[model samples]
Each structure stands twice: as C-alpha cells, then as structure tokens.
Target: MAEVRPAFDEAARTHPPLREASSARQDAHPRQIRDDDLAYGLERVLDGLAARLEA
Candidate 1:
C-alpha cells in the first residue's frame, strides 16, 4: 500500500483532465505524463511482488 499510494498520487497529480479541472479549466493538455506514470507504477508494483514471491 505504501508503494502504491505514491504511484497513485503521482498519476493523479499529472492527469491532464484533473489538472484542467483544478486550475487550467480553459485548456487541454496531453496525457503522456499519466501514461508514463501508469507504466512505471505497474512495473514497480510487479517488481515488488515478484521480489516477495522470490523471497
């Protein structure tokens, strides 16, 4: 859970729609950051799980 929450917070912070809704309500931004976060977070989570399995 600790590992996951940072990932989720990072994704939430970078999500284009949420950014727009909160501050830049008149603009649209790319979702690349969020996508990258998703990939990175998934990789980290899977790696952690795999390490636990190996232990």
Candidate 2:
C-alpha cells in the first residue's frame, strides 16, 4: 500500500501518449471513465465475491 502511489505516478510518467478518443467518449465520460469500465468493475466485484465465497 505504501508503494502504490509512487508506482502509479511512475507508470503515468513513463507510459506513452494514448490515441485520441471520440467526441462522444469525452461527452459521456468527463471524469475519464473509458469504455467497458463498468464491465471491468463488475468483473472485479464478481471476482471478489467468488473469492469471499471460496474463503
């Protein structure tokens, strides 16, 4: 947990510029939530539930 912020900042600095997104992309998600973000979040939640059930 202590190293997470530094690691994230390092990755952000080192990563290459991303490709341009569409206008709808900007309008729909001003907060920078990309396409499929909901699906990805749902998958993560489901994984956590499965792990808890198994435990």
Number of the top-ranking candidate, with lDDT as the measure: 1
TM-score of 1: 0.46
User: Per-residue lDDT of 1-55 in model 1, one digit per residue for the tens?
Assistant: 4455456557768687764554432222347546766899999999999999999
RMSD of each: 12.4, 9.9
Cα deviation of 28 in candidate 2 (Å)?
Answer: 11
Candidate 1 achieves a global lDDT of 0.65
The alpha-carbon deviation from the true structure for residue 11 of candidate 1, after best TM-score superposition, in angstroms, is 19
- Give the TM-score (vs. native) of candidate 2: 0.39
lDDT of each: 0.65, 0.57
For residues 1-55, what per-residue lDDT tens digits would candidate 2 score against the true structure? 3445456446656453521333224335434465477778999999999999999
Clashing pairs in 2: none
Q: Model 1 clash tally?
A: 0
Judge candidate 2 against the unseen true structure and give its global Cα lDDT, from 0 to 1: 0.57
Clashing pairs in 1: none
Best model per TM-score: 1
